[model samples]
Target: MKTKIIYLLMACILLVSCQNLNRPSGKMTRVERVVSGQTIEIADRSAAVPVLEPIRLIGIQAPDIRQKPWGEEARIELEKLTLGQEVLLEFDVQEKDRFNRLLAYVWFGGKLINEYMVKEGFALAEPDFPNTKYMERLINAQERARLMGLGIWNPDQPMRQTPAQFRRQIGNRE
Candidate 1:
């Protein structure tokens, strides 16, 4: 009886560990809703009843809703790409931003969604600390977009400044 009980306890422990280990790691959950250009509600099973949490794509900057020019276009494009689809979220060092949003590198199917946004000129590389895994890729994508005159990259585009420059300009304006 003692041996049977010990075996049963071991089995239960192994089962619990296995279940925990089976959880998705570094994988983007499905997009439940698109909140804006900078935020999206992702379906996360880790919470009770698969709650939706806003995920902020790290290392890049998409236009803010209140910002000038292609802000709406950026949000539209993001919606078109990932409004109701499953995406893979890759994390670097920091997992969450100051807003308590999940900071991730989003991927849909086999495509890198974050890089695509930059390549399409809807976003720009905006690396923050250790989340620089895709910094080079984002930069290259932005360059390609500029070369191709995509999205906000047109020669006549008024807001063709880099994110850093844009922020500085805004500060100066104030």
Candidate 2:
């Protein structure tokens, strides 16, 4: 009986290992909702909102809604690109943020959303995060956006504090 149990355990391990190997590093999931320019809710089922997980786009930070400069524009741009689309998510060293949102590299049509956002100038590179997998790529994209004067990168616009700085400043005021 002991031998039989050991065999069963081994079989289970092998099965799990094989399953993991078969699954792509970039897991396929559908976007149920766009929370903001930096975060999205993903699910397999067809739901209006999201019953699954909230995936935060890694390596970039979008402006807060209170920023008033480009916050709404960023959110709208993200929604235009991602709502109701199938996205593939690839996680880095860290899994989740302090907010419990899954930190990931979101992909759509073979393009990385994090990089795209930076490239489009809707977001800024978040260097403090441990997930620096695409930091260089994101920085490069941001530079291109800056050069091209896209989105928030336009020099004619008034300078606005980043989401991180806004959060910190708000905290200090309270």
Candidate 3:
């Protein structure tokens, strides 16, 4: 069992390293819409027909839409930053999620939007494996946001529940 696990781990590492070698140069695309705080739709013109591809911002998770004002605030903030704007998409190890949403670190005006959202306290640093190239940067941004008590970190009206928690609760109810 131990040997099997070791081989599996090695294989995973090898696969990830191979994927990293061919990292996509920033693909410039126009934001079609904001699905939520952490997701956006972009017009992908790579194919014969343009397709609206949903992108899930890597390294951070924002409040769920069911999380009341915090969720809406996050959506609004994301919209303010990205809606109708041309943004650059940088991919890491995994290019897409199980939902087929493109997983990327978004950049606008030379700023990493994923880190910006965490720094602004609009989202929490949620590291997902094999796609954590910017995890430390995001965690540091979250710390700064926490110290400054911005957005969801505000002492008086802070977001009490995490986006994951909110999602689980909603899922249970359904």
Candidate 4:
């Protein structure tokens, strides 16, 4: 009887932990600024002095600031959606990227901002593993945006290359 009870308890614990692997519930913070389409500065109110931290939106990549009008457009759109708004930051397997930016799925105004950006073609769905909680949704949104020829996906004026590729090309030129 003791052995059976221990096994049952262990199984239940495993199940619960597995369900929370992505850490869906997260810190509620206010956006201090929109740094770019896929990044923002958020106020960490839990700190006594309200420290500002950079948060990189997970599962998507926006045009680099050097990408001409496309980049500026993305930044402006992000600002309109998130600047000064209170947001929920859902974490994933890895908390921060190498750049020390907090990686999160930002929720605001009842929308997943990351996915929305892709859906509207302001960004592209780029899945970074260990943080793919919403990649599928983002990819689907991207497809729809592409089909509709929206924003960056517009056939007549589409962004010439992915942001990562553009960055690499710029680095090579220097």
- Would you list the C-alpha lDDT of every candidate in the order shown? 0.80, 0.84, 0.92, 0.91
Q: How high a TM-score does candidate 2 get? A: 0.77
Q: Where does candidate 1 clash, by residue pair?
A: 27-89, 28-88, 28-89
Model 2 Cα lDDT, one tens digit per residue, 29-70: 878888888989887356775477788999888988667768
Where in model 1 is the C-alpha error above 4 Å? 1-25, 160-174
C-alpha displacement of 39 in model 4, angstroms? 0.4
The per-residue C-alpha lDDT of model 2 at residue 99 equals 90
- On TM-score, who's better, 1 or 3? 3
Please write out the lDDT profile of model 1 over residues 96-163, one tens digit for every residue: 99989988878887777889888988887776788887788888998899899887777777456655
Report lDDT (Cα) of residue 157, candidate 2.
88
lDDT of 4 by residue, 1-174 (tens): 999999999999999999887445788888999889899998777788988899999999999988987899999999999898889998989999999999999998668999999999999999899888788899999999999999998988999989999999999999
Query: Model 1 Cα displacement at 8 (Å)?
Result: 50
Poorly placed runs, candidate 2 (over 4 Å): 1-24, 44-50
TM-score of each: 0.74, 0.77, 0.83, 0.83
Ranking by TM-score: 4, 3, 2, 1
